[model samples]
Target: MAGDGTIEKVSIIISKGSLEGVYPGLIMANGARAEGIEANLFFTFFGLDAIHERRWERVRLATVGNPGLHLPTWVGALPGVSALMTRYMARRMDRLDIPPVPEFVEMIADTGAGLYACQASVDLFGYRREDFIGQVKDIITVGEFYDLAAGGQIIFT
Candidate 1:
């Protein structure tokens, strides 16, 4: 906490691949930066897709097993449900002037927030450093993430 009882820094861990999963952390980090708070985003597990060179543009909203959609599991399990929902959400976001995932990532990076990929996840996914977008500061281990996130609030999204 800062002298005014506000957080001085924030470290967000993103572990899911869906649009909903990835965007919250992005928005949080962006908001934190806009508020003059130091922010760092740690990408791990499926969340790596958001920073992946090829997958970022294809990251979709997960409709299946997502109770927030207020739809039955069977309905969400339909072949085209996820795609349809993703398209709908994308249009909604666009109408709100929110950029796409890649552009949003770039925007956040431009704010000087540290963007990192988890080493364990990268190795498990057999992803090379070249596989990540240029905005990634580095692929670091959990220990390194903790070190970098020191004196900051840690949030898992």
Candidate 2:
């Protein structure tokens, strides 16, 4: 679509904290960047965890409520299911050569994509700007994000 010269940029909003939740946004941002499209990743609410240094390495798949998994919500609540699912995912990604979360963030940042933390979510959760990963360009408000993303497609994941 970008070759048409109409869609030159993209803004992605990531609102979930799980491993699966975080990947789609990063993957899309990376894909856009690879396509020579400018991309901005807006991390809000639980999504902020994806860019937090201490938690990024620990982020795991959220299995409990995922209807797509076919396992009932309570089934995913079994003691080790989440961990198992996360490991399986990690292995699957390894086979596909997908970098781990932190590395993936760094890779995207290295590609010139903008990484941002949502100010309201940061304030609501009592997180200081310094708590974010170095790749984050800045912590921004939703209005600021809108201004930055003007004329671009917006994708929420």
Candidate 3:
């Protein structure tokens, strides 16, 4: 439980390896921080792409195998399709007044939220420390992350 103070601790577990999943975790963590909550995000599996320097710029929208995806799987699999779709979606989201992922990430980092990439996932996926973005706090073990989550409201996004 959080202390009886002004700040509230919120732990968020990001497990999905998709562009859609990554943004929500970041947005929520940042939003919580904006409200003076102590936000912490644990990135696991494909979600690590959001933190990886090499992969962050190349993060693609999941058009295939995503039940909520409006585009067909074949279209998503087509070369340049995902990129085009991502751009289109970004434009559409902009029209709807939604901020881009990079901006959201900057906002989250600016709010001083703790951002951790899963060490086990990094090793399993062959990612190095140099591969991650500069804002990442550390590559933490699952046990360590859970230790932080204990007694806090944990949400999987």
Q: Write the per-residue lDDT of candidate 1 for residues 26-62, one digit (tens) a residue.
A: 9999999999999999999999999999999999989
Q: How far in Å is the alpha carbon of 155 misplaced in model 2?
A: 0.5
TM-score of each model, paired residue for residue: 0.97, 0.95, 0.86
Alpha-carbon deviation at 150 in model 3, angstroms = 2.4
In order, how many clashes per candidate?
Answer: 0, 0, 0
For candidate 2, give the lDDT of residue 32: 94
Q: Which stretches of candidate 3 lie over 4 Å from their true place?
A: 1-7
- Score candidate 3 by lDDT: 0.80
lDDT by residue (1-157, candidate 2, tens digit) is 3567667999999999998899999999999999889999999999999999789898899889998778999989999999999999999999999999999999999999999999999999999978989999999999999999998999999
The global C-alpha lDDT for each of the candidates, from Candidate 1 onward, is 0.96, 0.93, 0.80
Candidate 2's displacement at residue 97, Å, is 1.1
Worst 10 residues of 2 by lDDT: 1-10
Query: TM-score winner among the candidates?
Result: 1
For candidate 2, give the lDDT of residue 149: 94
